[model samples]
Target: MVRAKSIDHGIPGRGSFMPMRDSIPRRADRDTLRRELGQNFLQDDRAVRNLVTHVEGDGRNVLEIGPGKGAITEELVRSFDTVTVVEMDPHWAAHVRRKFEGERVTVFQGDFLDFRIPRDIDTVVGNVPFGITTQILRSLLESTNWQSAALIVQWEVARKRAGRSGGSLLTTSWAPWYEFAVHDRVRASSFRPMPRVDGGVLTIRRRPQPLLPESASRAFQNFAEAVFTGPGRGLAEILRRHIPKRTYRSLADRHGIPDGGLPKDLTLTQWIALFQASQPGYAPGATGTRIPGQGGGAGGRDYDSEPNRAAVPGGRRYGPTRGGDPCAPRAQVRQTKGRQGARGSSYGRRTGR
Candidate 1:
């Protein structure tokens, strides 16, 4: 059994990342506080109540991320059969452990991305940090053993994930297996140290049937990324480099895609059809040839081409690493308090497909 350490109120600012020792000493210094800004603690009572309600634990096992000060954790213990919290800050972890020492709460102190998901975890919930919201969502979507998740993330992120403005590359990639939705909007003032932007309660549930076959996961993901981020005037031009423009244009017309429209303009079902038709052995006149490194296409960038492909700014490469794709397991948490406002502010804006 893990022993809870005594609380050290001397430390001024809340602990953020991995401290020097397991028993982290609290210091309210400006520099220390700034480093830990990514681990903002949720303080609003109303927001806490709303988050718990959205979770709908109902006797299920819940895994809460960054349970700072135990605002939500307090309610989780009452609703969940077992509540496991993964906190990166040692101080906060200790505090949670001590607070719920006799309850069905397990506090693990470390980076959540690196933490293992137990076989019994049925539900996941958290008010994710602005800097690592994308990474966290990707992790949750990819991980198994969790039936559903209710997360508090940046409002713009919630919008993109739910395909409000236009489908994002990441959202499009995952649409085959997971369904995402925006449940409620949480104001910026709901947090203790108010964030510049508002928050949203986003819920993600796995689909009973995936749109694409499991074998096509890799090809589908890469294809979606290239189409969204690849250089081109529109979908036609993007595919023209790999297939004949006439063929692509005909397919686009058949799918009701407007001329000169970008990839985001198409719906999820349309993308699936396009990807299926673009495979290497596609039909003679109607279907277009596939691009190398894409679905069922000829050889291109091998899995081991790069140990860890660098992450594209505002974009992420998720799923299991082929070789040691450095960007596969995004470990670094960004500080979102600088000139850019939030570190991943780019993801919030409309993606220029």
Candidate 2:
């Protein structure tokens, strides 16, 4: 069983959404919060299928945060046994209830942050507001339940969380306990009201074997925070302040750290090693095994997976092709350049999104 570990932490859609418009939402807002909370809702079928496809863990129940307009809910009910959706907007909450009255979905009208996640909830999904993404992530990580997640967040956040470009303090700290992956990039145009930055499908799954015990998570996070915020020119100086030069050299050589690798440079593997070494008696866990496809310290980012497959609700072909399950494979078509027709959406089955 995966051990539950909590850490202090975004957001996709805002908890309190704005009043609906005659048409799509606009820049005009009675309350400044309307825009701040993330009003852009997923409108593209490909993105919807991709987001649902990346969901991890095995469970009949799913807790959906901010089911705006029931775009995701429509497809979720078809596959999952039970779908519990939490929406901050009363209008949308009521709408979702009426929309899926017969479906196996429970609608809760309140802030997801305030709602208590059941201990048995194994998975959660959402298209969160980029502003509060970090805060929401903290809540999920701290929850006593929930094993996997599929979220639509800012592109940069998704990239950093997956360590596709490099590693970050967030990924470094959580990497030991969870596996993050980037399924695909959601273009801003895919949403009804386009957002400034494009969205990315980010998936998170609890590691089957944690590098450290649940009891050590708090201390380990603190150590990681220290190294990240500590004053030092490079990782060498910062890490040297905590461990002996001998141990530092050993780790550096093992991980092949360059002369002046910084704290952010360390991958999940290096972070685990450093944390374990800091303990009174250094020892290795049975499952420090590296994740496949993630060359070096980078995350396993799956931007492309399979040649192409049908991904649409029912048997109807929505985009490009249609036949098999909508969430079966990652396939979306898009031109890469200055002015493309529409944004491409794809999903992949891997450790990262």
Candidate 3:
């Protein structure tokens, strides 16, 4: 059974006995603490509660990362059945244990990535380390046991993960495997030593069935690697060099897809079509019109036939032209040498006669 401990109210001014406010607990020295951890602590009590609320479990077993000075840890211990915190800094871990000795909090002094997740954790909640947030998240996803997670991360990362369409590959790939939502955006000032940028809380729940097949996982990894390296080019072009031409051509032809590749807005069906088309004997139609399930016609309306197609200057439509700007004033060529001598001679002879 977990024990409860009296929260150390070190603040002076308030009466000897005052109830702890759910607001952020003031830090003794925020700047120094921030310097130690390379980040500020989330001191807002309301934000902490909101984050904890997002966790779906009954809070029987919870994992907290980077529980700095027990800012969020204080509130978590009060609400949860058992809380295990992973703190890399030994000093902070010691302080946490001492501060919440009687409380139902266990402190593990190590990096979260290296530490083994405890068995049977119903929920995982924490303000993840900024330096290794993605690695930590990936680690969590790899673990099949946890029911859900609520994490406070860099606002940008959170936004990318929860954003609609054209998100990062990490976000998009994992999205199919998990449900991600933004709970709230915590202000930068909410921390003891405020961070330069604001942070946000993201709630992610595992999907019932994994999105990609085991065989496809490696392929997806390779695909993502290629796409990120050359984001502006067609997906097929980027992938062609890494994969076999036959495989690439088969995928494109079978889908009746253009070699130009998938657009940023390509749907899951389009992706599946490409996969299907990669099979043997796929022929893309010559008309270059995209027909659903037709395998090789262009998929969208052709812009090449648009009326009032802007003409290129110098009558050169597709390539470079031979002339200069048509709008500029033309320069007159002055007669020199022989022409000037002839004019002068005629005037001299007429004058002499």
Candidate 3 residues lying further than 4 Å off, grouped into runs, are 3-36, 230-232, 239-353
Model 2 lDDT on a 0 to 1 scale? 0.63
Candidate 2 lDDT tens digits, 202-259: 9988766554444455556667767877788888888877777887777678777664
Name the candidate that leads on TM-score: 1
Q: What is the C-alpha lDDT of each candidate?
A: 0.64, 0.63, 0.56
TM-score to native of every candidate shown: 0.73, 0.72, 0.61
Residues 1-353 of candidate 3 have per-residue lDDT tens digits of 56533222222221221223333324655446456456677888888888877778875878787887788787777677888787655556667877887788776665554444555576888887565677667556544456688999888778766754345555544443466877688998988667788889988886544433333333343344344455446776765655467765654565544667543444433443443333234343323223344344332223224335321111111111245321111112112212212111222122221
Q: What is the lDDT of residue 298 in candidate 3?
A: 34
Consecutive 10-residue window with the lowest summed lDDT within model 1: 336-345
Q: Which 10 successive residues of model 3 have the least lDDT summed?
A: 311-320
| Candidate no. 3 TM-score | 0.61
Question: Which parts of model 1 are misplaced by more than 4 Å?
Answer: 1-26, 29-37, 56-58, 242-246, 283-353
RMSD of each: 9.2, 15.4, 26.1
Checking candidate 1 for backbone clashes, the offending pairs are: 11-26, 11-27, 12-27, 12-28, 13-28, 307-324, 308-325, 308-326
